[model samples]
Target: MTPASEPATATSLPIGSDADLAWVRHQVRQFAAEIGFGLVQQTKLVTAASELARNTLLHGGGGQAKIIPLISGPARGLRLSFIDTGPGISDVELAMSDGYSTEGGLGLGLSGAQRLVDELTIDTEPGRGTVVTVVAWATGVPAPRPGSR
Candidate 1:
């Protein structure tokens, strides 16, 4: 993984409406596929992206997502950052807890997105807005499962 200080190739997509959700998912899938992510990996990343994008639209009152392709060291990965300037989260820890939702949802979005990625970070301040970032690294060539070889 590349250090946070280092720059990587990135692009931004606006997430202002419902239709943008599909666009976000499509962009993530295409980027993951281009970087040789396996089917399962691509699906997981796309799913995570979908959840975040929806949150950006519905909860945050719309935002933008930054997608960065990471190719450094021994790993290849994609990083996504969702930013919103709506009413920020009042309690991030609770928000991240399973089954805790402010919108009457099942409350799986944040936590589930965390599980699908190698790294997750959330930054928010009440009345200031929020930023949620996630990174999923490709497995590269398949390796034998643990204890299988």
Candidate 2:
């Protein structure tokens, strides 16, 4: 397992159009499988990727995602970061709430994606953009991080 302070191996993919959405999902599934993720774990990661990719296209106006394979203190995991340059979210807390939606969506995008992963973090500036990062471990529990609950 990689040391806690070491960076994991990572790859970045651009998400600019509708076609890229499918491609992102495919890439995520392929990578997850390559790293020995089980079928259910792969599905969960893929579903979260799909939702984030769609949000990038429809709301963020296009962005990119980075996939990182991780190992820390005996835990093997995958980390994904979705970044966009469109108008940022105004109310991150509300956006992360389970029943909040501004586009008539079922209001499950952010919260649902959060539930599917071991850890989720979001950073946004109202006029700048948004960056959401999620991580899932093969063991279904993340290694404890300093200052995290």
Candidate 3:
């Protein structure tokens, strides 16, 4: 049986810096490039991370973000995850949908993030917290599994 073709991995970065959002974005871009991600894709992914990180700070009252290198399916890649223990999103599906936003938010919304990446996953509960994850490969490939990762 052919199990799968996973590739090499680099170190992951866990972040929590309210005043260092730009630095965080820079790190993501540089690391994504190191992981073989192209320039345009790197911009999208980094921008997505920036949005999520900003939400964590502005909406969630600050939290944590992590950049994880993903080595799977014969391609080099990286994963960015933003998590917060603050008041969770009330409506996940609605929030993820385009043109949906609460009164105070920027209204650019999570849809942009979803559009920027190859794969995206989100989990949230009203009072628990929110976790947003994005995965992208070196090439602009579609997400291999809908729910596996």
RMSD values, in order shown? 5.0, 3.5, 4.3
**Candidate 2 per-residue C-alpha lDDT over 1-149 given as tens digits, one digit per residue, 9 for 90 to 100:** 22233345778999999889999999999988876788999999999999988888888999999888876655567788999999999998898899888889898999999999877888899889999988877755456465331
The lDDT of model 2 is: 0.83
Candidate 2 vs candidate 3, lDDT winner: 2
Better of 1 and 2 by TM-score: 1
- Show how many residue pairs clash in every candidate, following the order shown: 0, 0, 0
Query: Candidate 3, which segments miss by more than 4 Å at Cα?
Result: 1-18, 103-106, 140-149
Tell how far residue 26 is off in model 2, in angstroms. 0.7
* lDDT values for all models: 0.86, 0.83, 0.73
Which window of 10 residues has the lowest lDDT sum in candidate 2?
A: 1-10
Q: What alpha-carbon RMSD in Å does predicted model 2 have with respect to the real structure?
A: 3.5
Best by TM-score: 1
**Where does model 1 exceed 4 Å of error?**
1-5, 141-149
Which stretches in model 2 have alpha-carbon errors above 4 Å?
1-6, 140-149
lDDT tens readout by residue for model 1, 15-99? 9987898999999999999988999999999999999999999889999999998755545678899999989999898999999
* C-alpha RMSD (angstroms) for model 3: 4.3
How many steric overlaps does candidate 3 have?
0
Candidate 1 is scored at a TM of: 0.89
Candidate with the greatest lDDT versus the true structure: 1
